[model samples]
Target: MATDTLNANVLVLNKLWQVVDICSVRRAICLLYLRHAQVVVKEGGAFYTFGFEDWKDFSRNSRGDDFISTINYRLKVPKAIILMLYDRLPPRRVKFTRKNIYLRDNNTCQYCGRKLRTDQLNIDHVIPLSRGGKNTWENVVCSCISCNMRKGNKTLKEAGMRLIRKPRKPDWKTFVKNRFNTSEWESWKDFLDVAYWNVELEEDK
Candidate 1:
């Protein structure tokens, strides 16, 4: 139970009360202890903030399962916290990776347009490497084994194949939208944009 509480997700807000990121409960408590962040709590439709000691005092009378027992007291695990200094969202750049490529392509074969599981997809070079094709966002796409073998080392023209959509660099918002986890804390809904609340997360390779 203690381990579960420590590892639970905690929503992080900027000074401006905007959603910034999600952190672990352990990190949140550490920030609170160091005076770098304050717990943000909601009660009676109003939001409130508390420092580490004040939160500990309040927890004395609180009753819930989300508590960590210390030698002298039990600390309530906060669901959200606000950074005392940070007011900016994280950088908006999306890393180019195999998982992201699959995400961008919706796990569908660019050549055959059939959606498949990750194991069934391969990153195919639109233009073969032997022909001087560079590995880049616009040059690679998800392909099923059959389509990959069919288009092997051949240009689209030679293979009589065409992509369903033209590949381009995806914006950060598009990528983040796909990564939002629907199971995030309910307290986070007050800070998160409506568009982000219902999204799902994908595991990175």
Candidate 2:
């Protein structure tokens, strides 16, 4: 059996709010005002208490309205830590992949404002790679297969097409979505916004 005394980080909660991160169960009991209750085991020696029950007991027995209550606790391991990690940096250059091009142009066709699916999309270089344009995020946008096929190896001007919007490097939030794990993003949504993401590009000028 796994040792119950293993030191693990825990999320201390009170009803709907997350109160704190506790390094150990003992610390959570003492420092977070949880009671030392017990649960009966079939072997009759080992026992445990519901963390929530302990908090309720502590709150009821306390002298004043300053009672504390914890709703739940979840063990925090390396996987949990990984899921919570977030970075606030932007990518140096955008890749010439379908996802990056779609994200860079907000899933809209560069020649038209209509939305397109991943399989239905194509990456188009604004300046045409054949004509000194590099395959960078700032120079790529999503295009329909027809637009891509028609514009092959030629500048938009040469293809007699105009862009609905100029392609530019996305800010940090878009960059993060393009590269980071989805689980890591939940904790970061509150800190990142569309404007915060676009601000860095604005400052580049």
Candidate 3:
């Protein structure tokens, strides 16, 4: 049971309390003991020391031994941790791919403005490659199979088709924000960027 709890997922944060990445509870505990990180107490909203002597003051039943147990001492588990050394936000670079194009277009057909699943969507080159368009982010967008077939190889003007929205490359922030549901990550919610939540991570030092 202790080992299982130690293996649980832990959300890691930068010194500024930004969600940087996730780690195993075991790793989080190690960092706590090593003083590489301190646990953030969400209850009273405080950052608490995780030193060995400090943890020993608390009873096992009060805190829990799964987080730490050695000799006659034990301590509490950390659901979230903040590193002492990191400062900068992680770097983000949006990739060029079919899945990313769907994300950029909000999984909706740009021509008709209807949201659809992956299977129901098609990647259409804004300017067909047959003419002179390259397979670039700006040149492609999400379209339904119907729109793709109707437009065929003709340009929008030629096919009498019009785009409901302009297709553009997704920035790293917006790209990652739309990837998760609004209510899906409660534990990670506060630590994530409020206005622009992206989970891109970089090395601490």
The collision pairs in model 3 are none
Tens digits of per-residue lDDT, candidate 1, 93-177, equal 4567989988888788988899999999999999899999988788889899999999999999999999999876666455544
* Global lDDT of model 2: 0.50
Candidate 2, residue 192: lDDT: 45
* Candidate 3: worst-modelled 10 consecutive residues by lDDT: 196-205
Show model 2 residue runs off by greater than 4 Å.
1-97, 174-189, 193-205
Residues 6-75 of candidate 3: C-alpha lDDT, one tens digit per residue = 7776778788777677788789878877888877654466445455445546435473334556576666
Winner of 1 and 3 under lDDT = 1
> Which residue pairs does candidate 2 place in steric collision?
39-48
Query: Using lDDT as the measure, which candidate wins?
Result: 1
Q: Residue-pair clashes per candidate, as listed?
A: 0, 1, 0
For each candidate, give its TM-score against the true structure: 0.59, 0.45, 0.57
Show where candidate 1 strays beyond 4 Å: 43-45, 61-63, 102-121, 124-147, 150-181, 185-187, 194-205
Q: Candidate 1: lDDT over CA atoms?
A: 0.81
* Superposition error at 26 for model 3 (Å): 10
